[model samples]
Target: MKARSFRFFAPFAFALSFSFLSAAPARAAGPDPDPWFGKDKALHFSVSAAIAAGGYGVGSAIFDARGHALLLGAGLGVLAGAGKEALDATGYGDPSWKDFTWDLIGVAAGLAVAWTVDLLVRGTGDTHPLFTAPAPGEMKSLGPSGLRVVF
Candidate 1:
């Protein structure tokens, strides 16, 4: 009886978790088509990808539902990306869709990395990635070379 319950619960948990994670990135305001297409785009892409990845990791750790975590993370990442874009558009920085796209990509990458790592770790034991807000300095690359600050 115990084993039967476990079996049913496990699949339900997995399905629920996956549904949430997969839907996260798509829930954000549709990507702005105008700004995500041009110059200095690589920077934007990298940032977004990192945000996604970071958010997934943190989200998974805090929430019982894996999907919820992914959703929250992706949502936060999109907000960050949009904020950056809006700032640039207002002449605060360079408005580059390239950058926003990169941010999204970062979020995705973060999610993938976190998920893969979590799966591998779970098989060995019940460990998850550490979660903490990234330092301000950790946010962007420095100089024309786009070198990240390592600490």
Candidate 2:
């Protein structure tokens, strides 16, 4: 009973303490409450970008359509950004839309890069493997000395 009561009241007590602390007089000189290009925002952007790129790779392997893969990557990035903001909203950290915006930008950039690389790998044509097959009857073998051809 005692432990349960403590657990229940602890959060309230903690919240009340913050309220008291915040009640202190403000100073004239201070940093912005939330800057658009802060370190935290940069972290959010980079992490979202990585998530998007990874999602794109996985999606590309799973889906034959490039558009579908792009959608999956974008969806994953948005979900990650929103999830983080949701966590912040739950009193864990400062929640700001600016961070979400940066995350979105990062997602776009990551997707663009992945798409470009995919295109480059596929060549000018649609869905071509990186290595093209040699002409018939030209045997190619892999040995200790690397690729060897027997004409």
Candidate 3:
């Protein structure tokens, strides 16, 4: 090929190559489009974590063992993460290993949290808010029902 002919196709070749290369990583990283800090990773993490927590709750309700619940939670987390990745690979979204990595992290965190709560509530299993109002009989009229404080 002559120099002039090659020169004519140089821009087109460059554009095509650039187009293909650009899609290597930035597939569907949400609005930011940054593969590293994309919202997709966050979504993956949350969804997997929720599924793990749900599994723990269900297993705990049905099984008599805490460890069994934890194990089932971990298994459900793994399955949910893999299912999410497989769904993404169907062209509905960009499939990313990084996203799945975050999902695993979320699963571990969720498991740890559920385990802690289970242990904490083992004896009483009573959950209550910090503040409690007195009954009508015990209610005091010593001061205003509501007070406004100025900063």
Candidate 4:
């Protein structure tokens, strides 16, 4: 039963991720033009880490297996990143392997961090960061200026 459900949920989750990637807005070049956009790399990192940690935690809990959870979390991260890149390649946004790679790294790092923290805490608590919704009127910049705005 668990195996069957795992298979079902995995694909469903991937599909949902793909849908989200397809729906993400294209990258714009500028100060985001949005007043609410926070031009902070820390925020992006935090968001990525939080999502990854959550993925790891949920995977761990559902599978009751660390290896399986790690694999699933990494696979999901890579798939989601690649899917997003593909969507961006459609001229709707910027398709960047760099971004995908970094995202994957972030996901892996987050998962590792969560696992380590969990172990250190002796499984008594979780250290997964809470996910936060982006604010409206957010804009992201693209390119070398290290400008990527999000709301």
Tens-digit lDDT track of model 1 for 14-40: 999999988876545886555645545
Instruction: Show where candidate 4 strays beyond 4 Å.
Output: 1-46, 122-151
CA deviation > 4 Å runs, candidate 3 = 1-34, 123-151
Candidate 1 displacement at residue 13 in angstroms: 71
| Total backbone collisions, model 3 | 0
Task: Report the Cα lDDT for residue 31, model 2.
Answer: 83
Off by over 4 Å in 1: 1-39, 123-151
What TM-score should be assigned to candidate 2?
0.63
* Residue-pair clash count for candidate 2: 0
Give one digit per residue, the lDDT tens place, for model 3 in 2-100. 999999999999999999988787556466454766777788788888888889877665444565677889899989898878998998777888988
Cα-based lDDT at residue 145, candidate 1:
86
Ranking by lDDT: 2, 3, 1, 4
Name the top lDDT candidate.
Answer: 2
Q: Model 3 residue 110 lDDT?
A: 86
Best by TM-score: 2
Cα deviation of 123, candidate 3, in Å: 4.7
lDDT of 2: 0.79
Ten residues in a row with the worst lDDT in model 4? Answer: 124-133
